[model samples]
Target: MPRVVSALAALALLAWSVPSAALQVRLVPPTPRQGDTVMLFVGGTKGARDVEGSLGGQRLAFFPYGAEYAALAGVDLETKPGKVPWRIGLVDGVGTPRKAAGILTIKAAGFPVQRLTLPDGMVNLDPQSEQRAANEAARLRTLYDTVTPERLWRGRFTQPVASRKPGEGFGFRRVINGQPRMPHAGIDYSADRGTPVVASNRGRVALLGEFFFAGRLVALDHGLGLYTLYFHLDGVAVTEGELVERGQTVGTVGTSGRSTGPHLHFAAQLGRARVNPPDLYTLPVRD
Candidate 1:
């Protein structure tokens, strides 16, 4: 009876010494390339509730994954190649807060320089047109920078064009009219005039208007600081504030904005990261 009691006491002591399983997460591609997207996989919270987290300061949008959850991490060109941090917080059943954190390493992505010799007037706009371009850029910045905390998209994103191809790549160091210009920040698709262009994902139409450079354009907000823009559109099928599904026709290809030929300029913005539109196509979706 004394031996039995000793064994019981030893077992109890071991249990007390062992720490509880932590509610923590691991970063997929723990080191992400600039302009890429990574997945944050939260583990040990199989049955836990109210899990929340952030990767490199950008708020994460979690989706159910069996018992645990996962979130998408966007790494933009602005993310300098270096180490960053990841964090998570959860309230346990007893209302106690649990927290965890780790570091993320960012790898460099090199972009190529592009020299486009468009007409002098097209490259060097007059004062009025320059002001219009500035205003258009400001309007877009405000929209992309706006944070809509809800996740409005489902499934992986799709290309706006049927071919799913790109013309000039994103992050092109542009030199136009012998003057350096802001790097081309979007993926261009060569399409016939009147060809259909669809929403990259389910989203609400945020803006539809004519601009000096983009021409008739449509902007869609997929919430969670994710926004997609379709430029040089010939026809706008959706109106501002309209909800559109993935692959739904939002506009038609056109040489509307300052363009030499009909094409679709499809761009995606995740918070401040002007990432490649196709990067969104690779993000996993939740049911």
Candidate 2:
């Protein structure tokens, strides 16, 4: 069940009193499941210059949303179900910093299992290929570790491609050739070859590479520890460090990087947590 924290109770949890009526803190879905991106909104911060917070141990960068402040936090797919400690800090108009603490409740989520029979070469990598993949992965990790201290995206996020099938395959435990492999961390959209793929939101192109497993991919840094990835492209249209608008074409769908058919593998990461890309559209943000 979703646990909605009341305003007064939230103030008590923070153990602080404000000059205003009350300090309002809320988690969009109340109780979020694993692999979900949760929005944290803080009200009663009328003249605050900056707002920041941390969930578990991951830092969150808050941006101005109307009269309040909002930030996105990720719940890892393997996060344990329970209450996790969260802290928030804000600098008032006079540079007076105030702090608040609370807890975020997470709910358990069950992912479906998928079994596939692929060629041995596709299932296993050679020594040389293994090293290349490792290097690529490390580079991606380094990119995710760096947080841009600004909000570049506006309004809601959109799907990268048009697909008749519903969004699925995220967090799916894959058993390839009777051997368990890492879970699918992204949503796959079946599209025709050369189908244009657009940026899910506005951001700067962080990296573009032809990877062993991901094939040709583009990663977008949406600022504030939020990133969107478009993988398995037929071709790329944007360059690294270029600012792209929302819905701008970044690549084309194709059977690249271990894919069985033409498709676009879209993913989102908040800090270190791999979150569902579809969740971005559900956030309560507007232009």
Candidate 3:
């Protein structure tokens, strides 16, 4: 009887002393390359509906759970060199409280970042371009205000439709008339004028309009201010305010505006900040 009592007490003590690693999340790349997108993996715990994820000092941009993992966007891993802290915690569907966190390291790419150029005769347009850029910047601010990082953490991302071959580089520097310009904002995929364009993930149609540079465009809001823009589209498949599913056809590729050939300028945006979509695609999503 005494032996039995001692065994039970010892077992209870071991249970109390050993900490349960409820969830094991590590930023896959301890030292992520510049312009790299960091992905977090969860282990040990299961059945979580959403996982709150944050990078640097930012709050959770998307909540990912289930078999699929959620990801953050607009990370310029090159700009901020050094250790980047990340945190993840589970969200209880019924209001039970539980959470966890971990740190991630970031290393410098050491390569010179790319830049674009502007036109020569546009030298005198400084005030004009500055005003326009400022206006656009302000618009982005408004968008980011509504799309907090926390809201994006509500769901996991669905697998993106394969492009096979992407056309444009995400941050390729451009030289216009021997003057530097803003680096390219998104990735471009070569396709026929009418090649179908699908949603990278589940999202709502946020903006459907034309712009001087973007041409006929469609912006899908994937909650939490996370959005994807399809520019130089030959046609729009969905209307404004329409809820689109992952892989749903939203538009067709084209060379509608300021383009040399038929292609789709696929861009991903987190709030007002532009991020490289290819980075998200490169990360291991199935895990």
Best by lDDT: 2
Q: All candidates' TM-scores? A: 0.86, 0.91, 0.70
Give me candidate 2's TM-score against the actual structure.
Answer: 0.91
Clash tally, candidates in order: 0, 0, 18
Alpha-carbon error at 256 in model 1, in Å? 1.5
lDDT of each structure? 0.82, 0.89, 0.64
Which is better, 1 or 3, measured by lDDT? 1
Off by over 4 Å in 1: 1-19, 46-50, 63-65, 164-168
Q: Per-prediction RMSD in angstroms? A: 3.6, 8.7, 5.2
lDDT of 2: 0.89
Better of 1 and 2 by TM-score: 2
Q: Residue 280 deviation, candidate 3, in Å?
A: 3.4
Instruction: Report the C-alpha lDDT of model 3 over 1-287, residue by residue, as the tens digit.
Output: 99999999999989767755566655655566655555556665445555666776666554444543455544662356666666766654443445766556655554434543334334335677657646655654565556734332123443333455744576666656556666777777877778788887777787777654676888877776677788888889999888888778988887775566788888776644556676555555543
| Best prediction by TM-score | 2
TM-score of 3: 0.70
lDDT of 3: 0.64
Pull out the clashing pairs in model 1. none
